[model samples]
Target: MATIASQIILHPVVSQGLKFGGTTLGRDKTYRALQYFSRFFAWYLINKGDKIEAARWSALKAHLGTARKLMRLGKPMEHLQAALRAAFSSSPALETITTIARQLGYFGYLSYDAIVWASTIKLINVTKETAARVQKRAFQFWVAGIAFSLIHGALKSLRLAKESKALKASKTWGEKDLAEEASRETRVAQITAARNSNNAQLALDIFDVWIPASGAGLVNLSEGTLGIAGLISSLLGAKAQWQSVNGKK
Candidate 1:
């Protein structure tokens, strides 16, 4: 990525006909530095609260100030021209910095229960509201996963049993033929059950691990969306479990 940045900084002749208050800042090495400084300054203004952002801005400003002093510029135009050149030239760097800052900010702002759960299952120990919310979400994911598995398992088992009975009735089968058909059906049923279980496990991992870790940041979707989804899945899973329990009774 740094190599990419260097390539862009060197190759792109972004600085063209650049003038600040009638003072020409020609496209050259100095001009590129000036551009970088200016762009960094703008980025600082946009993301000023963070300590790192402030420190970087201060360093960049000081460098530009030092350059100004060395140039012995009495006119404001000379300083303005230099600053403008830096701002325009440093766009690539500024964009990269901004993106990184945003990701860091998002990480700090969000709660991730997966980490907490991995460390320990004691959700009550986590005091933060965000942590609590994340724990609830994780639990919902588990419940949903279970609910789907139970309901799906029951339905699929019933379906296979019915199909087996039908096959037996349709065939004038000897004991050996009936036994072979039953074995084949059992194998099919086992494979299907395993596949469905794996699917449920995948769903659980997505909601519990993937979403909390990084997926949330990548999508930039509202946290409320996850909350709503968690709620629905929890309900479905609970209902399925309840029905299964009642059916067994």
Candidate 2:
């Protein structure tokens, strides 16, 4: 029994999980996954005529959302810094513009979202109408950010595709040029990886966009649909973050 316990304590998965949960973002992702699951379960319960259970799940979802808002209190400035960095990046003009726009949109969304949070907690009293307006504006900015992100992803994918094709078409003279060919192959591989990452992000943004659009009254997705979409996007984000934390490709 002692040997089994020691082995469990020293397991690699256990260690990696601890490392993952140590970061703020990792914790938020976990919460988000739970939150969205709650949302979906609440809807399912309601359809089954279980009002009490549905109410409990709904409350859990709301509380988790409030916790996430608190966690992101100072995050707007991070988006602002990202915008500035994007402005100075050596990307093409359209990509740079879209990237900066996306970051700035996030900055605006988070700034307004902070105000909504403060009002919710009674840190500063705002009328219900005002709070609703602010929330709508925040969701609007979120939609814009996702739109720009999709554009950026499309442009990046196109650029990477061209680069990959060109690299593949390049000819090597002989053994002397073998090293250059190998270098070209490496660059092509890097491009492919980057394209895959971009594509994944694009899919995540696509799934996420509808939730904000519904909030902004631009669309009317069912609660269950929004819940499932949010869950999928959160998992995608968590996967990317996990790879980053573990130094994996």
Candidate 3:
């Protein structure tokens, strides 16, 4: 029994999960996954005519959302700092502009969202209409941020494609360039990895945009659809964070 318990405690997956859960972002991602799952389950329950169960799930989703909002209360300043750093980055003009814009959009969104959260908890007093307007504005900024992220991802993909083409074309050269073959192969691998990462991020943003768009009234996605989308994106984000935590390539 002791041996079995030690083995279980020392399992790699368990160790990795503990490391992952140690970070604020990881915890947030876990909560986000649960929140979206609750949303989807609630919708499923509703469709099955189980109003009592659906209400419980719906309440869980709402509470998770509120908790996430509280957790992100300090994020606006972080985004602002990121925007400032992006403004002075040596990246290409379009890339730099889009990066700054995206960061600023997130900064604005989180700032307004903090206010909405405060109003919700009565930490700050505001009329219902005012709160709704503030929440809508926050979603609008979120939509803008996701839009810019998509654009940035597209541009990055194009750039990587061009680099990949050039690298492949070099492979056909004669023995004169044979000495650099290994270097070229390494660069090609890096480019491929970058393209994959960029595509994954693009997909995540694409799925996530609908939630904010719906909140802002720019789109009318069903709650079930939004829930599934959010769940997918949250998993994607969690995977990325897991890789980071595990130092995986």
Q: Count the backbone clashes (under 3 Å) in each candidate.
A: 7, 0, 0
> What residue pairs clash in candidate 2, if any at all?
none
Report the C-alpha lDDT of model 3 over 149-220, residue by residue, as the tens digit. Answer: 999899889999999999998785578777688789999999999999999999999999999999999999
Q: Mind giving the per-residue lDDT tens digits that candidate 2 earns over 1-249? A: 999998999998888888889999999999999999999999999999999999999999999999999999999999999999989999999999999999999999999999999998899999999999999999999999999999999999999898888887885678989889888878988998899899999999999999999999999988899999999999999888888887888
Q: State candidate 1's TM-score.
A: 0.28
Predicted structure 3: lDDT: 0.94
Segments in model 1 whose C-alpha atoms lie over 4 Å from true places: 1-175, 204-211, 214-219, 247-249
Candidate 3 wrong stretches, greater than 4 Å: 172-179
Clashing pairs for model 3 are none
Provide TM-scores for the models.
0.28, 0.98, 0.95
- Output the lDDT of residue 241, model 3: 97
Give candidate 3's total backbone clashes: 0
RMSD per model, one decimal: 26.4, 1.0, 1.5
lDDT of 1 by residue, 1-249 (tens): 999988776652322212221232221224334434443454545554576665665566445534533333333343344444645653345433433333333332222323444334443465676665665554444333334334444554455567656655655457767877787667667756655554553454344332333233434443334433343433433333433333421
Error of 2 at 140 (Å): 0.2
